[model samples]
Target: MNPLTVLRDSLYFFQRNLSQIVTLCLPLVIVEAILQRIVDDAVGPDASAGFGLIVGLLVYPLYTAALILFLDARSRGESPRNRELLAQAVNLWPRFALLSAISTLLIVLGLSMFFIPGIFLTVVLAFSEYRLVLRGEAPLAAMKSSFNLSRGHFWRIFVCILAVLGPLMLLKEFSYSLFSKDDNTLLSLVLDSANSFLQLFVSVVLFRLFMLISDKSDQ
Candidate 1:
């Protein structure tokens, strides 16, 4: 799997389907951003990190799950109904939420050990959500399968992930620098929406990687 090609194709898909993507996921993204802002205001930064995780677990999975289903439908050349996709995602919410929570906890635990281990864990566990959503595995099983699936493809997956996420992270930092925490709420919402929208491309690239590696492994 060529990471660059995956990156290129993911971006192409993102651009080509920007309208559909936005139509399906943008509300959830904006809602998430708003909820996050509320949490920050309520608890301040010094509050337990778990509060942030809790909020993420509440909002992130809904949109991400929808996007994954949406991407799958598009790849198969089916014109998906946004409402139908959202309904399916809502139905799948509990399991996906569990997967998200597990993934976050593991990443946090790894980070607590050391920064490098956290990155390593992030790379290794990256495919867990795909396994859960795409393959219909239970949450824990999906995580285990992701560990197994990612075993030999660590660098490849890492490269794809970094390629997709690096620029998004940089944009996030730059956006934050442009506005203080107390900056105009509307501007912050717009930037946050943009960042969240672009972050979906990371899932697209990984979906490509998962398909590639899954095919290769099957052979």
Candidate 2:
């Protein structure tokens, strides 16, 4: 798959469905605002606020999957009512929570061995939600499948994620650096909310590309 093509299509999709996408992401924005506040409060000059940052990172994939599943339904001309899609997505919460816990443990263990294994496990598990929602697999099974599918494609996915997410992240950092003097707390929270929305858009785009590639390979 061509990266440029994927990026273009993803941008087009995001532009066309902006309103619907924003609607789907509203709840996540609220949650992220709360989380950002917690993180700001927890982190300090000398101490590392490790666990909270980790939790904050993991929240992205779970919610991204939920939002993408809803978008996918709408793209297929199915009923994509917020309530129905959210109910279906929420059903996977327990599974997401379990997978997050297991992945976190493995990552921590991997870090003990060295940093490479931890990074490897992270990229491998990156697409777990896509597998869960698209293939209708159980959570652990989805995690395993994502690991397998991502083996040769890990770097590709990593690059794709960065390509889509890096600029937005940089912008957030820049904004926080510039205007956060008066009250960095509120500014930081707003940045988090915007980042969450951008992430959802990127996730849906990447998930759609993955599904397209999977289908082509199957045929």
Candidate 3:
């Protein structure tokens, strides 16, 4: 549960497997960007926030599940084929999507209550994806397990998530801050796509944390 050790390993694995990570996630990110653009055109400038959120949710689970599986495979010294990994992800999609949608709504609701609650929920339920994808648990069951598993490991998970996502958020803000609202929509999507792709590193970091928690619990 050492945050520094987890961050160090996350960066090490992320750098060492950068190419493979790109191979697993980049195409999906591109497709998500394309779909978002198409939706933007169809819905026009006044689209509801919910519509955009749903659109992102639809594509998000695919790559996320694949990346999680990729990280797990890599941990076991298995070089899984991209197609094979995606096929399994597809099989897991129904549960993953449901879990994601539920998590997103709850987090949004939490955020609405106050920003701190949202961050709290995010840290508390961080392990649901691992439970659902790795253990094949039902979505609700995974959520329950995630909530339970995260207990006593709160600060460690928080730091692991923050170390990766905090900088990512700042980078996106700083990068986009240089641009204007009048900037080309394509430029906006490109910036977002880069940010989305980089966030997959957060998945790798969590996988490391999941491994640490599992090892500790076993001992």
lDDT of 1 by residue, 1-219 (tens): 778888888888889999988988999999988988888889987899888788888878889999999888888999989999889889889999998888888888888996778889898888888888889999999888898999888998888888768888997898799787476877877888888888888888888888888988999
* Residues 1-219 of candidate 2: C-alpha lDDT, one tens digit per residue: 776777778788778777877776667776866775666567744455565556555465446656767667766877577776667767777666666677777877887787889878767887777777778778789888888777667777777777877898898778777776337666666677777677676676567667766766579
What ranges in model 3 sit over 4 Å off? Answer: none
Candidate 1 ranges with C-alpha deviation above 4 Å: none
Checking candidate 3 for backbone clashes, the offending pairs are none
Can you write out model 3's per-residue Cα lDDT over 131-164, one digit (the tens) per residue? 9999989999999988988989998899889888
Residue 104, model 3: Cα distance from true site in angstroms: 0.3
Error of 2 at 182 (Å): 7.7
lDDT of 1: 0.86
Instruction: Give Cα distance to truth, residue 50, candidate 1, Å.
Output: 1.5
What's the TM-score of every candidate structure?
Answer: 0.95, 0.81, 0.95
Please give the CA lDDT of all the candidate structures.
0.86, 0.70, 0.88
